[model samples]
Target: MMTNILIVDDDIHILNLLTIHLSKDGYQVFQAKDGVEALDLLQEKSCQLAVVDVMMPYLDGFELTKKIREQYNIPVILLTAKNQIEDKEQGYAAGTDDYLVKPFEPKELSFRIKALLRRYDSRADDSVVRIGHTTIDKKSYEVQTGSRTILLPLKEFELLYFLMSNPLQVFSRDRLIEQVWGFDFSGDERTVDVHIKRIRERFSTLTDDFQIKTVRGVGYSLEAKRS
Candidate 1:
């Protein structure tokens, strides 16, 4: 399937350049000039990835990314003129999956976007991600605990993969927002709570206890073990 991409930039020239390149690469493109319009469209449609400019009037890319992380798990590439390490760190903190300094070639950006999206595309087709007896099926969208096989919604499955991939690392909610949702998402920290709740409920029937850990105010971690 041709992936859907959303590009948000205030510069008409930059937006047009990206659109042309992305379309040539066989992606369906969507464009917006500001954060509010980007987030509004994101909420109403399905998208695989987003490329957002860091500087924009009203809401900047950092805030937009934080919002996206709250409700969606799409790849986000942040485009910024600020070259400082702290700025990059802030972008990562807000949930940008990748960062591109401004004045970059559109072709280069398209390549990076494809590479990022390919990781997700690969995971979606796998039958299982095995960690001991626990089985996570990417194709059927299910996670197995003991004898019970729990069905997973798309976001929940991606969450599981991210947690499982990282093992014991303590991820803050802000980081989870970035990794699971895109940087341009405008939801709140509590949104993560809701999804985690639903995921656990599905696992509950499969086992009296299972393996998604909460580190109090820190956030969540996934471990491969009996719960």
Candidate 2:
């Protein structure tokens, strides 16, 4: 299948430039003038990735990224003119999988896009992993235990799936963040801790088959318990 890429920018020149390059690279390009238009385009078309500009008229890139993160499980690249550290932090915090400063080479953007797509593609394998009585379904992004079915946020689900996939193996916060999020993740290790805490709290009463154990000064592991 040909990959679909959505480019959202108020700057017509930038949009055209990106569309030309991405299309040349064999991607089916979709164009949107602003974040609002981008969301509308998403509703009608299933894009594998989105390239969003930071300064849009209707909805800004950060807000658009947040909405996309909540509604979809696709990778997003934030395009901005500012190369400030604060802007990069805001972009990452807003859930962008990658960030690109304006005046960047089209080849660099293509490379970053390919890298993000590759990471996501690796995690898209259709497999069901079970630890004790709990089952983690990567295909459906659902968790099943006994008579209950649980749905978790995307990041939490990915984190749990990674740990459960390698049951009993300890993974440090840095490792987990790099594996679950991208290697370019700008957030600290606290991000992983927060996700782990939420996962534990959510499944505290849902199942007794598995536990996420913290390895002091290390990281976490999913230990299968006898039910």
Candidate 3:
């Protein structure tokens, strides 16, 4: 099945550019001039992902992202000119799955779009792995520890899964970013740190059997501390 993508931007040129690139990559592309139109199209038919612009007339990208998150479990990439830390933070807070600054290479955008969509891809078998008492089900994005189960946000879950899958193999921040967020992702190392912190906080109370260890001056590794 051809993946459907929605491109929302007031600029016709941007919409055309994204449409051309995404369509060439075999995605069924749809375009909207603003958030309202995007929402309307979403109601009519669902899209696998959305590439949205920040500066739209009636509704901006941030608000549109929030609205999309309210009902859809789809990935959203905010394509915008704002590249400040605060702007990125705001985009994440608004529920955007990825952020791409303006003047971005279409190839880079394609990489990010494909990376985000991969999270939603379904597999033939349940991808489950167990480390001590902690059980991770990649298919469901749930981590089961003892009698309790916790659901993780996408990035944290991906990071945890990657580390657990390669237990004891230390991975640098750059490597983690490249493998998890895709090679063309423009975000820096801080992104890895933030997701690692969240994952550690979530799993800290669940079990001590496995620990995500920071290899000072190196990177991080998941070690099973059998008691």
Q: Against the true structure, whose lDDT is highest?
A: 2
Off by over 4 Å in 1: 132-162, 167-227
Q: Over the stretch 199-227, how does candidate 1's per-residue lDDT look in tens digits?
A: 88776556543377899978988766653
Residue range 1-227, candidate 3, lDDT tens digits: 88999999999998898899888999999999999999999999879899999889899999998888777878999988877999897887676879999999999999998887876664223398788888889878998999998888888888998888778898888778865886468989989988988888877877897888999997999999866
Supply the TM-score for candidate 3. Answer: 0.62
Candidate 2 yields a Cα-based lDDT of 0.90
- Root-mean-square deviation (CA) per prediction: 6.4, 8.0, 9.2
Task: Give, for candidate 2, the lowest lDDT window spanning 10 residues.
Answer: 122-131
Regions of candidate 3 where Cα sits further than 4 Å from its true position: 122-129, 136-207, 211-227
TM-score (all chains, Cα) for each model: 0.65, 0.65, 0.62
- As for lDDT, the candidate ahead, 1 or 3, is 3
TM-score of 2: 0.65
lDDT of 1 at 155: 83
lDDT by residue for model 2 (1-227), tens: 99999999999999999999999999999999998899999999999999999999979999999889867889999999999999998887787889998889999999999998997786676488877778889889999998789999999999998898878888878778866897568999999989999999998988878899999998999988865
